[model samples]
Target: MVKKNNASNKSGNFKTNTIYAGDCIEAMNRLPEGSIDLIFADPPYNLQLGGDLHRPDNSRVDGVDDNWDKFSNFRAYDDFTHDWLKSARRVLKHNGSLWVIGSYHNIFRVGSVLQDLGYWLLNDIVWRKSNPMPNFRGTRFTNAHETLIWCARSKDARYTFNYDAMKNMNDGLQMRSDWTLPLCTGDERLKGEDGNKLHPTQKPESLLYRVIMAATKPGDIVLDPFF
Candidate 1:
């Protein structure tokens, strides 16, 4: 049986709004079982980039080529995904929920593992970027969207869902799975010392705002492993 620690009862080991810097699986294992309520993950999408991409202006398009996005093979990536997801599941309460965002490179794989680990999927949302970057080479159609998978620990788990709040946000209409939100830009995006964008995959606050408003209450203990 899962030992669910409700938010009203405090635990010394867990701290809200704190980043425990270490391996994701290791860090999550340190927390008490059934402690977290909502978890939002933006894991590395192992996009195997063959080469660099450039725009019509000749400026190189700095795609997601970071070392973190690299995995030796599909097997290695799957193992990594399983480990972190297992830890996340253990730390999640019986009624807790998790949300993961990924591209075609890994979302399907992650979804399979989530089900294997007993996570009952709620919805697969498509975040259509209102201003997505154009495919410079035009080798394929513009990849203008990403998918977010929302799930509970199990099918029977009574999870949080503010349907009325969501309806209100959507102007009295039921919210659709296809969200047309823009990517993180302008002041919302962090800049480094050289005045370049710091993080390559920064999710916009508007996107998360809708997520939180729809599925979680104000005091819910939301855990973001990599957002």
Candidate 2:
């Protein structure tokens, strides 16, 4: 079983490899400045679904309709994003890097905020899903990709980039901005007591593994604000 640590103290005594449960902004604020080596955040995409989605077979689609994904409006989401990002930056070491993933619904805003906060944009990686859900209604193209923004604390900050590791993972070729990976399914996906998915947006561990390998060392501290 995955161990979870509820971080409720303000003394910033966090340990590595332990999952923390609480508001990300508050948790990050409790950490000391320049304490984290890397951070990977998969924030809400704020997908404002009007109603239930149905497949061609009339089966209800299990879309991301969780309450956590909901916001009063764009301004509200922007506020939330800014708060967590500010805290994240405060805890990140000067040479550390950060990665954030989101869909079209919110990535643009996130990128803008990152730039405004003095984060030097590195690359916007596209996670192209090999087996994406089709748009059953045919109203639009199938959303087959999500964007990941990688950045450093500032323009001159030295950061880690495991170019050789990434090339090795890419069959001896240098990996491009586009990454092709499968969605979380089969036994890799976690299920709840009801046999349903535990998290609506549980990312594939392959994706996280690549991110960690590319940006961190074996003993470096890695934080996941949305874990």
Instruction: Write the residue-wise lDDT of candidate 1 on 73-95 in tens digits.
Output: 99999999999999999999999
Model 2, runs deviating above 4 Å: none
Q: Mark the 10 consecutive residues where model 1 has the least summed lDDT.
A: 1-10
Kindly provide the TM-score of model 2 when superposed on the true structure, using C-alpha atoms. 0.97
In terms of TM-score, how similar is model 1 to the real structure? 0.93
Error of 2 at 128 (Å): 0.6
Which residue pairs of candidate 2 clash?
none
Query: TM-scores of the models, in the given order?
Result: 0.93, 0.97
Prediction RMSDs, each to the true structure: 5.3, 1.2
Alpha carbon deviation, residue 98, candidate 2 (Å): 0.6
Residue-level lDDT for 161 in candidate 1:
93
